[model samples]
Target: MAVPVPRQRDTPATESAQATPPAVAHATAPQASLTLLVIEDDPAGGLTVPEILDADRHRIRLRTARNLTEAARLLTQDVHCILLDLSLAGTPGGSGPGAGPGTAGAGTAVADQLAILREVLRIAPRHAVLVLTAEADAERAAEAVRVGAQDFLFRDELDGRLLSRAIRYAVERKRADIAQYKLAESKLRAQENARLERGLLPNPLLEGSDLRFAARYRPGRSRALLGGDFYDTVRTPDGTVHAMIGDVCGHGPDEAALGVELRIAWRALTLAGLCGDDLLSTLQEVLEVERPCEEIFATLCTVDISPDGRRAGLCLAGHPAPLISRPGRRAQLLPYENSGPALGLLPKARWPRRQVELGGAWSLMLYTDGLIEGRIGEGRERLGQDGMVEMINRHLDRGLSGEGLLEASVTEARRLNGGELTDDVAVVLLSRTDG
Candidate 1:
């Protein structure tokens, strides 16, 4: 029978011996009945452990292991904490069952004494661990805690009450450490997303032009700030304002990255004086080279408003035509005749630029297919171009313009679907007022 060890008062402080582990915020509640795994060198599994009881008087379950191998095999998800005997660290047969003869002879006295506890930590990093030692080995016990154990125990002062309290405290502290790690990880991810959003979204270069530009973009993926939809607006040296919008085939990070590449290439080519079929062909080549696979493609629409704001050139590559609204007439889709296939679909596809008459003082809205693909109700009916036109007309009738108009339109689209749309959406409105 194992004698009941008396509790000691004023144990030496272990803080000065080693750096304390960071205190993490407590995110999860403590377990009801804790399970403790005790690792010792007694092959008979005869380690005497006090019957530990929790705050609610529930007896804590116990499991014992004679070596590191057995301890590792017994370390299951249900085991909340570990009680390791420091003496096992130096036992010749306790290095582990199958551990080579050289394994025990490799480290210094202190290293060998802590090797067992180190192995336990490696196998069960997330679980709380407590080290057990004799009263004479108090310094080494403190060193065990510094190495990674949640706390150290002196066998001389071992009792049911002290052991129970130590187990509870160690479990809680481990939970807080995990929660803090997750919180820090989440914060870092958020910061990275914000940077990506700013880089992916377009900044209109409408300086020295009378065009009033407004845009709205929402990624369909949860917790994502950007998607495969991209757009840009810029005024050239000749005073012609050019705007373009496009969508890649997928809604993943790869697709989004490809969209950014295409947008940047378009802006560079446009500034370099490439337009119409010449521009589209170069962009198709870029897409063919940059896309991850042959099946990936992008639909595009581009509009260049003449300096006078009375005439514009429109080109579509398997993309939706922009909606045009004037002072007197209701909003209508511009002619999409002579549109070519989406980029990467046809090797020698030609996107022909069609001339359109944009009477002075009009608003042109260009968007991806995500806007018109949403269901209006539970029926099979979709909010197609006609529905979107109707919605825009309603918002315009309410005297909405610029930012307000774009926000209201997107909001209404989401509301009509009864929830968030499952595809990325990008919309750009360029309004010109001829004085």
Candidate 2:
């Protein structure tokens, strides 16, 4: 009687489940038994070997295929390993003339003999394979091993105990090889991602400026370094410091790329002596042309501090007003009354530059809406402008400033949201210390 080998067949979903799950879902239980498919064509009958036995004495179930066609039919996910008779003769997977196939006009040489082995390997990439051959073909057997076979067994050495052990060992060794490949692949992928991250994020151009800058950015997507939110600070050759933060509409790679484009455009325009409404109009043109879709839009906030550092020009393109904190004064939002429609939402719109006094020493924070849109709890209440202002005041009471201030604010926001904030958050802080 053929032993029962309980195994799960491969489905698209099953293949995906075999991969690591992102969230909780069905778990695959360990397979109960292993099945081996033996390929051979003996004139009288199938493999003459006796019934194979596993280590637990449970009989190793066997399925015999006389030719390549039958072998293809028997190859299934449930079959854990294969025992192929290399000496057997037939076409590759029951196709073409079996005499010679590898080269255009070569005879049935060693290459053709091993062509069947190659076909078997191609058809069953994830399964383990072992070869059965005569002792006179020991050279061919070793060559087969080099080609991809797990091991080769001589006809005289074929026994129930040796096969069972070989089956188990071959299965384990195949799994180890796959695991090592995946590890190497993942490491290489991570290194590439690190390179991408460095390229995407900008380096501040604050040379010869006394403005201390700090920033905090987090992508809502797992394992992502850049997001749809972007920001940068640079000091103009005229000694005026300029900083801006903006957010593209979506939370995807395309959106992230768009954000980077906008940041670069802003930097180039600022360096080329564009500011306020003119720079924004040019950016709007860039946005209208570069956005992935007509419906896409971006919110932006830009500030240009005068050479003396006591005042700044603020422009809001449907973005939140920056927050300003000075000694003896609680942190508060900058004026947003003159804010215009977000870019791409209006044609030929104008962003008015509002002049504001910054005092002698203060910290100015510009951020994307993500920082304020997080849920306050499990409830529908969001940490809107009012709530964010209040939170910043509390942090100010704790005497936090610069990097520490930004980190604490983000942590508190996430804590209040009950988990990670489900949007890309980007916050930039620029501080000036004047005697």
Candidate 3:
């Protein structure tokens, strides 16, 4: 059922006027529709911006602001871009101290406007901001870009198509800048962390000891080089070699720094012939002075072997007891009784010195809590004392001794956690066997 539609006829004069002009056939373009905020302070006559069309010929939806206060109010999440008029009367707010050089006195006003742009960048890190400057002040427009604006547009050349393209480009450029900036920041942080870790980790000074030294370290903080875990070993003049391992309660850089300080103080005191209670007491004093806050504390375990290398003295301060294994017997934990609280907890805390008989052929293992605390399987149970003992026995049966033992333990712990342990794990193995 088709029906015919009638067409209206026009007079000769109307037809002639409706014909296109010679220049009307010039290359036309499309425009894109975008939501934009125009910050202008002409109260008498509101913003009279020419229709800004994008490549698709869709006119931009414009919101007008007479002042900074109104502009702030109109800056909703939906506002994709801001077009700020430089001739706007009110000064911007919240300028920080690091305003660029040559911006002093009334230049402070310009600094404040730049600060506003910076704040906007912070708030809408992905949004685009284009400054509207007069033709003569085009240089200032460039400065605005340096101050974090996405782009600057001249009022004389301001048209719908140009404004739309500028907005699109600014948004994309701002996004790229943000991503690149974050990547660089991450790289710098990683470099700093690596340097700090080199200072925190333990270095074995067992140059002449017949015993094999092996150790491994892992920080719990994701992608961190080191945590609050620290260890050190040094052989003194009296042929009495001292070894220590400890852990602070946190995984921050401050905690790592404190751990390093404590380890250095321990080495200094031990080398100065301070042992047992005197050495530990001095270290506690150091912790009290150097710790960032009173709440910070550190746990430690230290071992000192005599010149003959047959016997050793062990001291513990709120730390896990070290494991010992002899040639013909299963490994066992030394009796850890009457151990004092961690350092910086109590001024008069006492760490009991216990005697452990290490035969000519024996190995002692010291480690932080991160090793045994990992989950063994999908269960809620942890690979605690029994698990560690069995694991060590199996390794000993396989003739895995010295550094090999420490490597096995660390690798096993990571396997149990299904990946790297989520805490800082530092393990030191001292094996003394008749050569």
- Each model's C-alpha lDDT? 0.84, 0.83, 0.76
- For candidate 1, lDDT tens digit of each residue in 367-430? 9999999988888788999999999999889999899999999999999998999999999999
Number of clashing residue pairs, candidate 1 = 0
Name the regions of candidate 2 deviating beyond 4 angstroms.
Answer: 1-31, 41-43, 66-74, 88-96, 99-109
- TM-score (C-alpha) between model 3 and the true structure: 0.72
Q: Candidate 2 lDDT, tens digit per residue, 1-435?
A: 221111222221111012223332234433355788887655444447666665555556677765566677888888889888875653233223443356343234456557778888888999999998878878988999999999999888888888889999999999998999999999999999889877888899999988899999999788777889999899999999999999999998899989999999999999999999999999999999999899999999999999889999999999989999998988889888968889999998999999999999999999888899999878999999899999999999998989999999999999999999989999999998867
Model 2 / residue 177 / CA error / Å: 1.3
Shift in Å, residue 101, candidate 3: 29
Better of 2 and 3 by lDDT: 2
Q: Which residue runs of candidate 1 sit more than 4 Å off their true CA positions?
A: 1-32, 44-46, 91-107
By TM-score rank, best first, the candidates go 2, 1, 3
- Residue 199 in candidate 1 has what lDDT? 78
**Candidates' TM-scores?**
0.84, 0.84, 0.72
| Model 2 TM | 0.84
**Scored by Cα lDDT, where does model 2 land?**
0.83
Q: For candidate 3, which ten residues in a row score worst on lDDT?
A: 8-17
- Model 2 residue 3 lDDT? 16
